[model samples]
Target chain A: MFLLPWFLGLVFITLGPVLVSLYLSFTRYNILKPPRWIGLDNYVELFIWDPQFWAAVRVTFFFVGWSVPLVLVMSLGIAVLLNRGLSFLPVYRSIFYIPSLIGGSVAIGLLWREVFGSSGIVNQFLQGFGIATRSWVATPETAPWTLVSLNVWTFGAAMVIFLAALRQIPTSLYEAASIDGASAWTRFRRITLPLLTPVIFFNLILQVIHSFQAFTQSFIVSNGTGGPAESTLLYTLYLYQRAFVQLDMGYASAMAWVLLIVIAVFTGLLFWSARFWVYYGDG
Target chain B: MGLAVLVSAMMAGTMVPPAAAQDLSGEIRFSWWGSTVRNAKAESIISMFEKANPGVKVSREPGEWGSYWDKLTVQSASGNQPCAITMQSRWLAQYADPSILQPLDDKVASGELDVTGIDSAVLDSGRGSDGNLYFIPHGVFYFTLFMNKTAIEDAGMELPPDDWTWDDYAQYARDLSDKLPEGSYAVGNQGGAMDTFTDWVQSHGETLFTPEGEVGFTKQTVVDYFDFWEALRKDGVTETADQMAEIPDNIIDDTLLANGKILIDARPANQVDGHQKVLDAAMPGQELVIHSYPVGPSGTGEDIGSNGLAIGATCDENGTKLTEAWINFFTENPDAAATYSSDNGVVSVDRFRTAQLENPDTTPGQYQAVNMLSTVGPRAKSAYFPSGGYSALSGALTSAYETVAFEQSSSADAADKLIAQVKRLVRD
Candidate 1:
């Protein structure tokens, strides 16, 4: 009887919305009107004719491609640095982790906009160096890179995860490498790289999934304009625009399902590929 | 034990019945978004209303403007909307749908609201296609061109003649660009070319939306608009699209008249009051002027753009009465409006409450706004409420302009794409 309530709550609360959204994807529903069966019209249009949808997908992939690798490398680098003895290590760790707390927030987005904007602090400094800079947020070329930089700058969360994994490694493994007269670089290549492979894979999959759903920073940075010319129009942002701004609930629902499938496929691929490089201790 | 259980069940049932029957006097919540000055004035207004109607406590919920609509929309969707809300005209249409709002037609007919002073056009603008009003406008708002007088003088150019055409404006931009320091552009175009294009199209006797809510422009017209801006970009007279995108909301405050970075900035008339900050920042000896946009090829000497203040259908009997009273109080209350307007950047919509206009304490920029609005007031077009297909149309136009500005697509290609997109998206 006790478990029944929790089971029922899970069914109704957590699983219900997902089921409803799934149904809605097949219907022509605006919030104002009752939903009607529309079959696969939304999905058909999304795949065949929606340029903005394609644009969003392209931008999302670009963001993930640029951001995920950078975040992984940076986090791994920081984790390795912290794993070694350093002065004021706790303070440095705290300082590095602070951005993780504030990242993906509106304040951070505004700060990003200010730092990268034409007359922003970055450009002002660049001007002092006699290097004229254009608006970073406005250009098609630099906007995506700016967002990628923002994502990489907040690698503290991933770094913490990597740090924990780094600590879990047996010190005897390093001693074995030292006994073999291995240099630091050779030991890192032979032991550290293999040991960290699982963590790197985990971080890569997680970051890619999260990056696909990025909304707030791009939305705020672009002031909902998504320009210099739709360069930073991320997939989730487009979904939001369709759902809220355009009020095309049916279309947005279709997009949501597509996003789910994309994430699932990517995650499945990562799991499938794990056998090649991600080695477990017992194995 | 059975008897005790029965008694407890009866007690719970009785408790619910009485609560349902109780009188409807409790806390009432009112929410709005505005500047600090507007917030304070709104607080006083709420207090006065609360005092007038005893037994009801009012809670004030205010926030900065940008995030206000998103918050309100979510609340309305969840059926948790505040009893009263301050709404903008642009968003009134989207929320007026049946699921989101209540109707106020009965309240209007019953004479609960004094609608005589309110403009009928403004009233009509608030009505949804289904004939339900969704929100009441707080005040009128229209765009104006504000200039730094010192920049014009420094450029050795006379103040642009009132009838200056697009060609003349372009030439003036060239002159100003040459005279200004190397880093500064002649003009900073805010809201992008879409805003300027909309105004240009409207002035040229073309409408962005048809009567049936379809996009109403030819590909050629859009191309011409893009070409105009592209030429200016090529001339290096106007800030590039990238440069304009970089400007923060507070750019109006930072660009001083004396330093001459921005010669002219297009902004809302209501924001004219905030030019005091600009004046304070101006080089020691520069002057400022506020004027209407220059006459375009298609624009009659009249300005045609957005102005605020429309009533919505959500006002019930009490809501209507309260809203009418509130509008009149905000507009007609000289001391309140003057204090509010001076502190905030807006010019008072109510002409009768012209105390600030006549007062010597008002900034020159403020007076210039008053003068320009007075001249263009009669000629101002009734603001259009973009109905169903408007967002797609706006997106198309924005995309077209951005494509040309970024040089990713030629002007012709952008125009064709825009027209095709509009045709595909617009239902009616």
Candidate 2:
């Protein structure tokens, strides 16, 4: 009886729509008309025909590649710095954590635009140092970097997780290392790094999944067109355009399934690799 | 005698019978897309409408321009769309099917919907691919260039003549570029603007799409159009590709033209007042002027579209009657027209347009817009976008221009890609 609610949610909320979408992937549906089955045409068109699909793939992979590692490194670094018995730690922690909560919001997207726009604060600050550059969020080469920076800026959620895990690490091991005349860097390299691997693995998988699904930052920054030469065209944003703007619900469904498979493969690979790297401090 | 004649003319111009309005009894929902100002105006008009029809009730469903279509599409899929849906002619083909919007030709014939004083040509613009009238157009919109008059005067440059050509306009921009303040460009880059390209195609005596909805213009036309803006962009007459890309379509405040960072740009004629307000706030003492687009080789290719109301297919007999009555009141009632003040587009009815033009309270921007409509309405061709063509062309054009601007592709390759992508989207 206790599991009934969860079971119902699993069936209706998650599984039902997923199955419906899977069926829709093989059909031609415009939401207004009855769906017409087209077999593998939607998938074929996506894989072999659409240039925008390829552009979206390229942009998304680039975004995920740069953002995930940068986020992991920055968050781990911040967490370590904050863990050093610092004053006003909670205040700094809250200040840093706020961006993660609001980073995906429309307001942040607009703020990012204002900050990276040609006449924006970033340009003004750069011009002060004689570093002339065009609008970062508006150019093809630089637009994705702005979004990457946005993803990296929201590293606080991972930082909080790492901080909790760092707190759970035994102080006796560090004290023993100290008695053996271990340097701070050597202690970090030998004990701290090995102990933090599981938590790092957890954050890595979470961030990779999260980065793959990232939509709102690109949507807002690009104003939903994925413009400036499709530089900011994330995979989810392209799916949204296909479904809503062009009213190609079936094709969008196919794209969604493809994304699901890609994410699954990535997660599988991560898990497989974790056997070599992740340490739970157990035999 | 003159006063009596004037009163008679006014009464003859009015389309609705005030006494007959009280017969409408049922409730209906009227949905529209607008900002707070327009919503307030719409509410005032609805209040007037409800007052005229004592037993009638109207629930408002307001939305922003971008999300309005998505919301309406979802509501339509569920067969729960509002009785009256605000529709643009550009988007009419997508929803013109009888399954989505009701055919209003029978209503027009039966006198259920009165389109009196509206031009038949404008009315015909509302027809779908099946030749069925899907909506009653209450306002007409056309594109025009808005210039910073103060900047031009300061630079000692005279405005282009009424029959200025594209070459003349380009040279004018080039001339204006050398005299403008540093960091300001001559024009906003409009190479990707679908409306401007439509005008370009039309002016060259070619249609954007045929009656059967296929690509009507050649690839050469597309290349030439891209080259026109590319030259300006390369010469520093327009903003950099990055700066141009930064200027969003929907936000009036963020535009380079509005911020005085650019001298001229093409925008909808009806948006002059909004753009003027933004410019006025952003840079005080800057005067803005609306001008017709530069004429093409054949002639002026100015094209016009409309914002109008369509009755949803799901409405019952009574609901349909209420909707018809509301449409009649909204379009034909002089007070409602006065309240709306052509907020969406220029008033479609001749009498209301004349009234707005003659009214001293009309702002300079509104007066210029109404006058411009009067000037171009006769010559302007109806802009007809096929189902999904608007979104497809808009995306393709932006992509094509961005590729060219960012040096990813040549003009010819971009044009080829644009045509191919548009064909796939529209044919689908």
Candidate 3:
């Protein structure tokens, strides 16, 4: 009896729409009328007929393939630098962490546009060094890189997590290594990296998932049309365009399900590979 | 006997009373797309309406242009759209069905909605493909070329002649480009602008879409249109593709044209006043001028559209009456028209158009826009956008142009791709 509200909320708010969307994936639903079932048609069209779908896939894969690794490396590097005993560590950590909190927001997306724009601060700084530059966010070849840089800029969240895990590492191990006259680089290579593998694996899976779902940055940067020859057409942004702008809810639903399955497969692979590299202190 | 007397008086148009007598009591939801200035104007006009009809209450739901349609679509899907919806003629076919929007023809035939003084051609622009008038057009809009007059004068070049053709337009830009200040272009790149392309197509004696809702213009026309802009870009008469990509066309504050980074660009005729204001603030002493699109082989193939109001299907009888009354008040009421100041487009009614033109208080930019519309309205052909046609064409045009601009595809290849994408998207 006490769980009625929670149960009702779960059923109505969460599961209901999910199931409805599953049904809608196979139907012709434009939201204004009752959905008409047309089995496998949306999927068939998405795979064979739609050119934008392929473009979306290419853009999303590029974003995920680059951004996830860059973000992980940046966060780990900064975390290592800050993990050493430093003054005002909390302040530095806070400053570094703020970007992650607001990075996915519309305001940040807009700020990123202005900052990478032709006459923006980056260009102004480059111009001071006598380097001419075009608008980084506008060029089809370089536009996706701006978004990659934005994702890397928000490495603060992972950095904080890494910092926490670094603190949890036993000081005795380092002391023993010092007594054995192990070099700093050797200590880091043999001890620190292996000990941090679990956390690295965690951050990797989380970031991979996060990067796959990215939308706002691409949407805001491209002005919602994913222009400049659809260079920044993220998968989720295309889904949004199909569902909202084109009013093709059924196709969007199919696209959503495809994305879900892709994420699932990728996650499954990550887990299967984790046994080989991820350390849990069991050995 | 009293009821009979009231009915007879109402039918005879003799016993006219305020909203209370006409039974116009109840609140109706009204939604529109605009900026803060337009929102304030709409609010004041709505308040004036509420005052004149004391028993009526209007709930305002203003939204920005980009997200307004998305929100409305969601609301419509959930069956909660506002009683009164501000619709554009280009988007009318998408929601014209009786399930989404109420056909206003019945209201007009019943004398409940007054479209008096509005041009019949403009009224027809609001009709869906089914011949049902889904909306009442309050403003008629067309495209025009906005020039930085100060920049042209500074470059020691005269504005293109009134009878300038596409070639002459390009030549003028090229001539001006050589003399303009550093870092400024002769024009903002408009190879992707759908309306400009429409003008180009129409001038070649072709329509953008057939009456049967198929792609009307040939791929060769598309190729020629692209080549026109490509030639200018190659000659440094326009901004770089990347710079053009950076600036959004809708936002006046950041537009290259308004910021004095470009000598000329195509913009909606009604936006002259807004653009002038931005230019005034952004680059003081820079004067803005409005000119019709350059003539083509056929003539000025200008296409006109409209911003108008429609009633949602879910509106109750009382809500419908209130919506009809609001529409009538907006259209027939001179004060409302004057307050609106033709923010969206030129006033559709003849009297209001004339009044605004004659009013000394009207800014010169606005006056020029209205006068330009008057001159072009007779010759301007209204394009009938099929369901999903506008959005599809807009996206495809931008994508196709970008591919050409970035050297990824030739103009001919891009045009072929554009036609294919449009065919798929529009009919999907």
Maximum-TM-score candidate: 2
Model 1: per-residue Cα lDDT over B149-177, one tens digit each = 77688778778888778677778878878
Least accurate 10 contiguous residues by lDDT in model 1 chain B: B16-25
Best by DockQ: 2
Which has the better lDDT: candidate 1, or candidate 2? 2
Assess each model's interface with DockQ, reporting 2 decimals per model.
0.34, 0.77, 0.67
Give the alpha carbon lDDT tens digit for every residue of A1-283 in model 1. 8799999999999899888999999987656556788899889988988777788889889999989999988999998999897889888888889898888999999999989987789899999999968888888889988888888898998999898898888899999889989999998888888988888888889898889888888998887767767888999888887777666677789999999999999999999999988977666
lDDT order of candidates, top first: 2, 3, 1
Docking class of 3: medium
> In candidate 1, how many Å is residue B257 off?
7.6
Calculate the i-RMS of every candidate, to one decimal place.
2.8, 1.1, 1.6
Residue-wise lDDT of candidate 2 within B281-349, one digit each (tens)? 988999999998989988999989998999999999899888988898899888889999999999999
The whole-model lDDT of each prediction reads: 0.69, 0.91, 0.90
Give candidate 1's TM-score.
0.85
Clashing pairs in 3: none
- TM-score between model 3 and native: 0.95
- Candidate 3, residue B205: CA error in Å? 2.5
